[model samples]
Target: MTEAVHLATARVGDLAAVMRVMDAAFDPLFGEAWSGAQLLTLFALPSARVCLAWHGEEPCGFSAARIAGPESELLLLAVDPAWRGRGIGRLLLDDWQAWASAHGADDYFLEMRADNDAAHLYSRAGFVEVGRRAAYYRGNDGQMRDAITMRQRPSPKSGD
Candidate 1:
């Protein structure tokens, strides 16, 4: 956590690095991690964005999102397990919100397994539970999990 970490917008060439982190971050049993081809398609979208985080020369975390009109949806936010509890995920979320704000997004949305521990992180970041989809995710283990949808709206200006 004390080590210097760098984060930047990721290009297509950074796919390998991104996937490396994704592989280490997401457990396959949950079936949350996306394939490289899926990521490549997202990279080709006009409204999509990807950010990669590095610890020295090693890629450690990443975030991806897409914007549509005044809203943006967080597609992914992952930190290598070894790099977790060190604020990388928070940094990625902050970066995404900043980027979304710059692009005129007023509301943000994301969904995760109802039992995900990351829910605490999102709650701390000001995202509020908005809805739920019953048995939305079918895990590789054949277990079904509810999806919790969360939303965050831009804070009003100080004067307002």
Candidate 2:
């Protein structure tokens, strides 16, 4: 049997590992990559939270989000290239939703380039197309891409 991957709340100190995963996961053509300094600035916000999924001693994936008022936005999620097929993205999604809910978020949101293949993953997670931004991102290939914004609300528990 395979050992379980552990999910932990990541701190700003974990930025290096998170960046490593982010850099490995996103291609420059996607235009969704963030710099180390930008990530540090984001983490300084009290409403922001980062979670890391670790397989034993190796960092496998991470998710970052900021919750404010009734809404939460998933800013980034990245899994190491060598670890893509093992459900880490879904794991991070679940944890992000739980954390956001605990912090009083009722609506979850995320936006990505429409061409991104992760749309299926988000759709499977209950997110739906809420809006779009035209020519929202500039790719390294010098092309513009539309951005699809997705939203989801957590389903109530039976006893709740």
Candidate 3:
């Protein structure tokens, strides 16, 4: 694997840049139906934690999640196409898991469009598909898409 890139906690001032990364990563799947502002609002909740990944000074990836009670939901995880396959996503996830563990989260969850090819990544990370919602996403083309919900439980001693 390439040298692991630097991963750090996201600051409030980084919202705009984070939104840009999310918009670029999700647009192909959701199309122009959702705006960056909407995405930001969804991730801006108090329980949310966002992390940014950088290769030197350039922003290359990001991931966001919310830890509430004993559960944490991964709202988004994206990497610049040019930076894919470099283990950046895994690094970002490792950071997120650590953050969630520190915040008392024992379970992690995420939802994705059923057709999303990146679902494999979640599977490879040990996330199991627990449920599916049909016709959950309305694409820009006005077509309906299904959503798959996945979850992962941290080892009892792992997160503590």
The CA lDDT of each predicted structure is: 0.93, 0.88, 0.80
Instruction: Specify the highest-TM-score model's number.
Output: 1
| Per-residue lDDT over 1-160 for candidate 3, one digit per residue giving the tens place of the 0 to 100 score | 4375788777767777676676566666476334556556655677887799988877788887888898999877898777888888888887888888898898999988898877888889999999999999888778999999999976767556
Which is the winner by TM-score between candidate 1 and candidate 2? Answer: 1
What lDDT does candidate 2 reach at residue 69?
94
How much is the lDDT of residue 127 in candidate 2?
96
**Cα lDDT tens digits for candidate 1, 11-72:** 99999999999999999999999999999998899899999999988999999999999999
Off by over 4 Å in 2: 1-3, 154-160
Off by over 4 Å in 3: 1-4, 32-36, 39-46, 156-160
How far is 42's C-alpha from truth in model 3 (Å)?
6.9
Candidate 3's displacement at residue 43, Å, is 7.7
lDDT of 1 at 122: 98
CA deviation > 4 Å runs, candidate 1 = 157-160
Model 3 lowest lDDT segment of ten: 29-38
TM-score of each: 0.95, 0.92, 0.85
- Judge candidate 3 at residue 28 and give its lDDT: 64
